[model samples]
Target: MKFQTFKVCGLVFAFLIGSAFLGSSGSALASQKVPISFNDYHGYTGTVKYIKSVAKAYPNITKLIEIGKSNMGRPIYVLVISNMKTGTTIDTFVKLRNKRKEGVKNVPPMKPYQGKPGHWICGSTHGNEYTGTEVCLYTIDKLVSGYGSDKEVTRLVDGQTFYVCPVVNPDGLYNSIEKGISQRQNSMKKDDDGDGKVNEDGYDDLNGDGHITWFRYKDPKGRYVIDDVDPRLMVRLRRNAKTDKQLYSVIREDRDNDGDGERGEDSERGIDLNRNFPEGWWKTDGMAGGRGNYPTSAPEIHAIAEFFTNNTNILMAQNYHTSGGFTYRPMGTAPPNQLHPKDVAIFDMIMGKKYLEIIGEEVPEAWKAPGSLARFKEELEKKSKNKYAIARGYELPRGWRASYNEARDRRYGYGMASDWMYMQFGAYAITTELWNPQKDIKDFPQFTGPDARIEAQRALLKYQDEKYGGKLFIPWKKFEHPELGEGEIGGWIPKYRSNALPGEPLLNVCEKHWQFELFRAGLQPEIVITDAKARVLYTANKANSAVVSQKGDLVSIKKGKSKGKYKIVEVTAVIENKGKLATHVARGAQLAGNREDIVWLIGDRDKITHLQGTKFQKLGVIEGTQKIPGYTGRPGAGPAEQRRMQRMPRFIPPGYPMFFRMRGARLEPTQVKQTGPKREVRWLIAVEGNTPLKVVVTSQKGGTKVKNLLIQ
Candidate 1:
């Protein structure tokens, strides 16, 4: 689809333009220019009408497919951009293949049979992960407009199809936008703090500065004190290094609206999207971080899950977040010993290498998490015997220099997304923390990079403050709280503080990360036709009557070197498949299948069955090994038995790799090797062929390369 390039504009101007374009089209659209400024990024509200605006602008290329609806009745629009023809669905290809399988050989090839794998990009599963939404929108704009123009972009798009959902949590995202609050939960309105009442009271704009910031008050028993090193930052008071008995504490508003003493004692939401995943989902109250009674409780999460279930062609996945600098990979809850050695090695290579190039740091090994998408991927591989390498949780650095503890925002937990993906899908999955607030500091080393701009954050903050009338920030002010009467409530706004960098610098950061994401998409698992040919073997007939019929089905006899030529099938074909798993868990009657339909086959003249090799299984099989029609059925379960199968653990033998896809990065299989002294460290390397391609190496000592090999 063609996208109109938008010129940069103020947030207010951008909102007006975007709103005006909503659900309208025709000659009036000719003069419309989309504003591409930082304000424009934040102004997006994910409205259905706004989707129509995007559609109208790129009528030829943009398509609004309603994958599902959110809990608040918001349509989950999937904006698909590709040069491939429409009305060409994966179903169509499947149906055609079934028809071909039913016919005999020596028949004309299925009329115009053409099929291609696809790639997926999703955003905003967490309500507070807003940067991903903007970055995704920007990516859509770039891809649609740059198609047939930009060489790299064009190659990526044309060679592979793209499915993008700008906002996975429409209700949460829109609610927060409307309320001007940075709420991480969905719109279920439960008691989060668990004081009493449901969402009765949350962090308020006590200072009226359009932000929820830390509020420190003077108390005789306070435990915090300003750090002598940096007053701008906070530090825990040392036990023996105090003079006065003054006490300090960070406080927000009370939860109960009726001035009740209880805080958010009764305000809890339905579930945390990240924790709702099926893998390692514990039944504890806070196990899944507010995961509802069961998986897929929220409509938004369900919709996302359904989309991934249907689109099995997707092999690579990427989910964007913010507030951290590290890139993490799967096996979240699994102990280091339980982690697949090969998978760990691969993750270290891809993530470690990328981190060094982008953030100039090495990803740390060994972190634990549960109920994550990474675990789901691991389960998928175990269930389907498909080697789907999925990665989740790309965490951006919370503190730019790693020494700022308060700056460590969990909003961008790298280990969460990366580890989940590696466990679920054999393909790649990554969660990139889009922006870092520390990067906004003028003297930050990142500003000196090739893509850096002078005082970018200052320019963005100035623009946002002026355009929004400071409604997007928190100005210093005092308020009378029931808990702490007469205390200053002003600190840092959600978007203006330590969580996110200034929008202007953030845009550049997003662009650079998006480039890396594009590179990641290129690394998704692909299939190639290494060889194809037919050969005839002659054997001696049981009875040497005359010359035995060489064409006999069994015991055919053709003595004395028969004059026959063998056709050597040789062609190089790259198969690109990007997959996505919407939510980690399934809800209601629907269970996201453990296997995606990424398979390849080579058949003979009979055509009754074809040799099959899939991303899940490294080995290939001859046709007719199984009686299943499309090879879509689960192993050990017959067609009739599969219908009655419940959501229980199923065993899958080795050689078959299962796959799953989600919002974030794509993952692929890699071999792991332990080298160096004591073999205490392990490295992950990508496997291209029989040969091993070194990606990462680890050691007891910290350094760049190990024995000439990079150890990122």
Candidate 2:
């Protein structure tokens, strides 16, 4: 059938009625339900139409950005949603909020705390996994439609920005739609069947039923026997318990279409997008499911990698997939015992509680499979210290099995998605199987009696045939098989089975799953500056009759009266990591320099004094000095002459130490300097005192002056 827009008129009417009760505010009034159903979303044109509808519906809040183009030249669009009033842009919010507190006053300041970190939700990384794309579309609709109406929605939108990429593998998705069967690889064709030829043959509809159903051939000695209780159910005889050798019944199909003895073994396959990430990239066959020889080998995967690399603000990730009824976390490949102790503890605390509340079960405490997206997220956290979570591998609900006794016992337990997330990224990632076809039935008990399970399968087939029409099962049809002569190609059709249910009920399930995903997104790590402080330390060294200043010559004594010269050299401050994590240094904080000025000098007729120290030591002089004959005099030099004098170092005795004092502060010299014009001047200094004595030293040049000197 051609791609047609299937409007759910009845569903939309019901939604409008229900929305009236839910919509107390006018914001919800503007939301109009589009006439699009998930069943028709198998085509690129349909997907684009839905995306455009969302964009046009919420133009003020939703913006569609073309991050890149797909191999087919289709625009890969990213939908960004944020509150305009708060001025909270995606990258801007993350960058500004991570700034240092001391530098908050400069230029543009951050907005007041909004109470949550920004969030990102991506979908359809796997081409065959189309459920996430539909879910993302629904989520966008919910967020925009409820912006001013729903309290929780408003809080989420205002508190954090949401970035959504609906389809990461559009090429694969489009191909699946056109081919009438979902293929896991991207659009690039390859020799997947391995017949030593490329894209030569693949599965064909031998029954001409417009669907690919399992084929069964009659064989008297078949290993598979019809259950005594239910003819619809087939059971394999155990190898050891078999009475005689029997034929094996594999999925019934002929390999080659043309009249040939050889089976069709070659068909096209594309790159596996999950294996194309940069974090745990492996060559083809080097890692589990690694498709290509290098990362970004596929155009679609390359586009996604480029998008994420540029948008570093994506803190949380959830990848949706088919039926398994469980929430999964991270550390995909590492043994559960090998997980980081602290990280494991945190993971248990968060996901453990969430799973119990949401799914009524806890994730099995074990390690998961390798080379999955969950492992990729863990590697990302290790590399950037940013948190990422993966919610994948959801199983179909058991409802599908309720109708058939044979299918009932096949229900599997929750698989990997949620656990992989918690173990790896420390964020809660959930994989929820959206729909359970086996609804309203108690968990199916294992059949112990003869033919009980087969009987159940017969009943299920009868119910499916009666209620959902013959869509669930293919009527047996005769076809001239290439090898089997005359054979019937018929069994279970795709959507009618439990795994692939109709779009209406599945969409509802997706809506609920999307809510949980939204909750997980809201909880991503939000790093903020809780507190900051600074401390200063002063060090000085003094020797007999001479002083070495560690912080320049802020202390000096001349003629026993204390100081004729003193200057504040450098204030040494060290920023400590008092918080739990390392704090980044602000861009401009005046870290290495003196904050004030004080000049150092010695007074005498010909008595020369020296100052020695290294430059850029955070203790260097102010690089300028003036000399005068007397303590009280006007300055005689300008900045030009001062600069010339600064080039020359004043070297004191070899062992002389340095002393330091702040400008306008008292100066107490521990050591004294003895120098005069050949005993022409005799000076006696007082040694004992409770407080340092202040002495103002003035230059004979009449312009230079120094204060804050004391004698101890």
Candidate 3:
């Protein structure tokens, strides 16, 4: 295939000139089991069907779960992709002591995939931002189809789990894509105009053209003027700007359906689902800050919140949006100071670096040379006015930034999903605004200066003209409006403008994001029981209770005689985190309903008796194999800055002596030392009749692993 770029009417355009391959390539097509096409958008119905097909086709690696339903009763789904037979949870191995007599079926059973580390990927939180839906579907196709074919994909599917929700707002997505009306919020039954009826006056296809496009009419007070380069494109004049061209008023191809004198004011448009989360939904003035009556008030958001609450294994999450082609990490509702130093390094140095590289953005110098962050911080202090930037050592890159308005010191919005996921759920959550025409499209000319937007619009119009045969745009046609009088009805189809142009451009955006997510998935903490051993120290025909007494430097245990055979066994197990990141964020375990990593010794309840260590021990946190670049905090670091400096690494600096005394006193370093991810746990137990022993390690996000011990 050959492609060329040329200048046309002050705009650079590229089109498919020719191709070497005459027919479709076997490898290019989707899996034979579930075929998908990116040439067009797949609304709610298509998405449901495709996911159902995938779940049916790949039963071993996929399970379709309906997390919740939308206001319109559409099922919101999450497809779990993992080796279903391979994982286990703590709840499964540990039996509950008491059972309630009342039949209350509130808690659902945990799935096998929930036992493994989880990466959540959801799209279409906003109905009109359906580009996210396609990206999610593309990611799903990549995961499912590449499972057996790609090595990395196979490992991820086998070890980790992916919960991909294609459409978070089903009614909004369906109305936008299927009904050809740009509905950005979820659907509701409330009457917006309060005309004693629900959903009475919405967008109506006045011209009966199937699409609810724009209707333009000449008006002296209108803010828009016909573009000189591309007459079809509407150019909005700058505020208070004088324009000689005829000003026009543009509105959706709609009218007053219920004779309310208002146009589409009482439509099914509901609360913004993204703003219906539980975090920062309340204002300081004791008022409702976000959409709906309260946080998680909308059915969609409530479902999501409930799902995250139940599924604690998810450590990484992504909420996809469109147009900006950038990612927003957490703390959107607060300033940068709220984030922990360790988490900041992980989100920026590791994940943000990879994201910038994937999107072809320059990484910050501080990120590249994290060891010299202090120097960078000094340099930034002199030149940068942003306090957060000066403190952090570098300004956030354009491609990766927080939604918090740092310059003005204001929150971006209330009740955002990513903020909730990070602050409360303890996940490395982010919201990625996908799609940039100049970046995603090959040979798409860069536009700049005052006329940049108009020039880009012109170029895109021409590009679509050549590539899509002008099918995406509806040509302006004369039409008589019911109330607004004479006008022309036409414009770029609503879905095609804000979203990535389907086919090649959409595929490009999807691939880059998928690659970035794959890298992130590889970073999830993987806890494994590397070694387990059981050795019998003593055996007796009958025993009752054992008592231990210590004298001077010696300890002895005395056993009482009983009518049962007993063998005292020493069990030791080595648990290690083999992945690239820690099991939890700095404050993850400290959050409500979360706990530190734990290791348990399991056997028959009545047959085994713990003699030394408890049945389970809390492993503070199992760090990952990979070292964080810019982070210097050690295990004993305190919350206060002064205390953190006091508890530095145990190893002395080059100029310092191994042992040092302060103020004439011989102050020795603490004897207790905390090491790396590996932890060796031991338990002494009395086993009767050679009962089987098992060692289990469970981390909320690091995953669960169990090993059987052989008593020798």
Tell me, by lDDT, which candidate is best: 3
List per-prediction Cα lDDT, in the order shown: 0.45, 0.44, 0.87
C-alpha RMSD by candidate, in order: 17.3, 21.5, 10.0
State TM-scores per candidate: 0.57, 0.55, 0.89
Residues 1-712 of candidate 1: C-alpha lDDT, one tens digit per residue: 1232333345568888887666233323332334244444452364445556766776555667787776566677888665544223223223343343334532223211112334567777777677777777777766765655566776666545567887877766765555556556666765565556566755565555545566777776777755444333334556766755445676654334546665554443345676555444552344444265655667776666556554544445676665564433444433332233333333444434554456545432222222253555565455443232223222322221111121222132212333344344333455665665344333444445632332334444554566557655554456666566766565445544423444566666667667766765555332222222222222222312224554546656555443232222221122211222111111101223332222222222221111121211221111111121111222243221343365456887788668657655534422222211111112111211122111111100010011111111
What lDDT score goes with residue 237 in model 1? 59
Model 1: CA > 4 A from native: 1-34, 40-52, 86-115, 189-198, 206-215, 226-245, 283-290, 336-345, 362-421, 437-442, 445-475, 525-712
Query: Model 2 Cα displacement at 249 (Å)?
Result: 3.3
Give the per-residue lDDT digits (tens) of candidate 2, residues 317-375: 56555554444434332223323333333334333344344544433322222224345
Backbone Cα, N, C clashes tallied per candidate: 100, 52, 0
List runs of model 2 lying over 4 Å from the truth.
1-29, 33-44, 66-77, 84-118, 191-197, 219-264, 278-289, 341-346, 362-436, 439-463, 495-500, 525-712
Q: Distance (Å) between predicted and true CA of 481, model 3?
A: 0.9
- The CA lDDT at 656 in model 2 is 65
- Per-residue accuracy of model 3 over 350-393 as CA lDDT, tens digit each: 99999999999999999999999999999989998889988889
lDDT of 2 at 502: 44
